[model samples]
Target: MDRAELVELLTPDGLTLLDSVGETDAVTDVVKAVSRLRAEGHAPSLVAAVLTQVKLRRKAVAKFGDFASRMLFTEAGLEQATRLRVAALHAGRFTAAELSSVADLGCGIGGDAMAMAAMDLAVTAVDADEVTATVASYNLAPFPSAEVRHARAEDVDTREFDALYFDPARRTAGHSNTTRLTKPEDYSPSLDVVFDRAATQPVGVKLGPGFDRSLIPENCEAQWVSVNGQVVELGLWFGALARPGVSRSALVLDGEGTHELTAPQDSDDVDVRPLGEYLYEPDGAVIRARLIGDVARGLDAGMLSPGIAYLTGDRDVTSPFVTTFRVLERLPLDERTLKRELAKRKIGALEVKKRGADIDPAVFRKKMALRGSESATLFLTRVDGKHAALLCERVR
Candidate 1:
């Protein structure tokens, strides 16, 4: 939102109108609401601003749950905000370490600060973007112990806080339609400066899950977190916040609750073996943390192919770290042969999964022209260093 829209939305009438408009996402409803509000004599800008926030609040439900209704957001800020479930874990780290205060650098919409403050920890959240800082201030207003500042992260005096949390801006400066910044150097507040702070104090830095692993500092604990099988963030913890003897870890938060796989360093890949009755696709966080070997060991599985992420075994055992599939049969990698085989089985519904293969599932599915009620998962991957196809049924 621009300054004018922000100004309009901050007024009593603007807030009341936003609440009255309620949460809506359908384009038709948005149009009807816009027309009605405009017909009621509200300014066009205020109407637009309120509707935009209405949409954001609807989308924010996945991250903030019911708290999303009480929060304000920019498109970019909401996109980057940590899920409250994950943010609570981040807060737990500081609390576990007995840290009483935190400095949340680049605090987009105060997601982390709110989590910290909810735990009764004093928080100073800062954002360089004026509008985001203002929005964060509003989101954090309920917590008297949490303060929001419109200032550069480098300008903050970290000595006053017992711990520091850096969420450097990973996208180009904007409230919407911003491009992701790939290079660490391009990140706001300078990753180099953030690292320098880590050297002297307890710090946690949240970065993209795919951040270059080689650049991770040797002294910190690197953790990849996934929520409901989606790898979300890679958190680097330093000093007291860093767990001893744990250089790499994968945290999985799914319906079964939280599970973690950790090691002093990346685990070695299990040796490739013949394809077995069951196939396991390691969780993205586990694969990203290079701890698939640990999971394979637990399941008594082996790599399907060298350097491939797929694992296979004869055991019925499985863990939250991997999705297990019961292999049905092997099929030829060719499209014509597989199409004929699928038709024979009367399999219409399909889930196509691939690893170490070059094939678009959508195009392949269209070619099959499937017509039946049966369903199955087709894995296009390698086994023992050769292209192969494995027809399987999900093992829940």
Candidate 2:
């Protein structure tokens, strides 16, 4: 939305309309609601703005939870905003250090800023886009300690702040077409500028989990965080923000709770061992943090192949950092052989997972064409650096 639409949304009548648009209101029913509001003599622009916000707020719940009720969002801003649970952890870092304030560069929709303010840390949040900055200002209105600015992150002076939080814009122009930029140099304000700022101050740079590891400095601490089994972000902590004796870490958060494994450096190498009674799929965060060996050691397991993240052991061990499975059988990667075996086992639904293989799971699942009574997960991966498949049951 533009500045004009946002200004209109702040009007008393517009506020009343938004209040009427409940979370239970069906998104498909927006057109009917708009039609009814227009019939009631409401201006078309105001009605349109209310309808649009109703939808955006509904979508924002995944990131902001109940707080989304009072927040505003842009399509792109919401897409890039950090999840509230994750942002709270980011805020905790500053609070734990006894830092009084932080400069949140590229604070999209004020998600992180709100978290910081909730932790009682004063925040100066900045965004380059005018509309996004205005939305952030509205979202942060309840927090007197937080301020929002419309300007480039590079232009922000952080000398007054205790630390900086840099979440660089990693995508190209326009909110509609989200074309991701692959190179760090292409990022807004550039990765170089962020790195330079980080060198002199305690800073955290939030990057995509798949960011180029080669560019990360040796002295900084890199932590990969995952939620619900999906790796969300790779955070590089610099200077005083870096945890003592922790150069790499995997932080996993799920319904059960949060778990973290840290090492002074990368995990030490472990010997490759044969597949046994159980198989372990390390959490994405563990793999990204290069701590696979730590999980392998925790499970009394070993890698199935050199450079492979999968771990195998003789017993089923429980850990929050990995998903364990009982191996039913190991099969050849041959499609005809696999199809016959699956059909014989009465497997109907299959959750196809793969690594170190060139095949797409969706395409391969269709080719299996199984018709049976039970469901099972199929792992198509490399064992001993050779193509193979494993039929397994999830240990839960």
The digit string of per-residue lDDT tens for model 1 on 303-332 reads 999999999999877589999999999877
Best-performing candidate as measured by TM-score: 1
Clashing pairs in 2: none
Once fitted onto the true fold, the runs of candidate 1 whose alpha carbons sit more than 4 angstroms away are 24-28
Model 2: which ten-residue window has the lowest total lDDT? 22-31
> Can you tell me which runs of candidate 2 are displaced by over 4 Å?
none
Note the residue pairs that clash in candidate 1: none
Question: How well does each candidate superpose onto the true structure, as a TM-score?
Answer: 0.98, 0.97
lDDT, candidate 2, 1-396, per-residue tens: 667887898888888888887655538776678778888898888887888888888898887889988887778888889999999999999988888989999998899999999998999999998888888998899999999999999998888889999999999865445789999999987999998998788999899999988888988999999999989999999888889999999999999999999999888857889889998999999998889888888788989878878888987788988899999999999899999999998899999999888899999999999799899999999888898999999997
Candidate RMSDs in order: 1.2, 1.4
Provide the clashing-pair count of each candidate structure. Answer: 0, 0
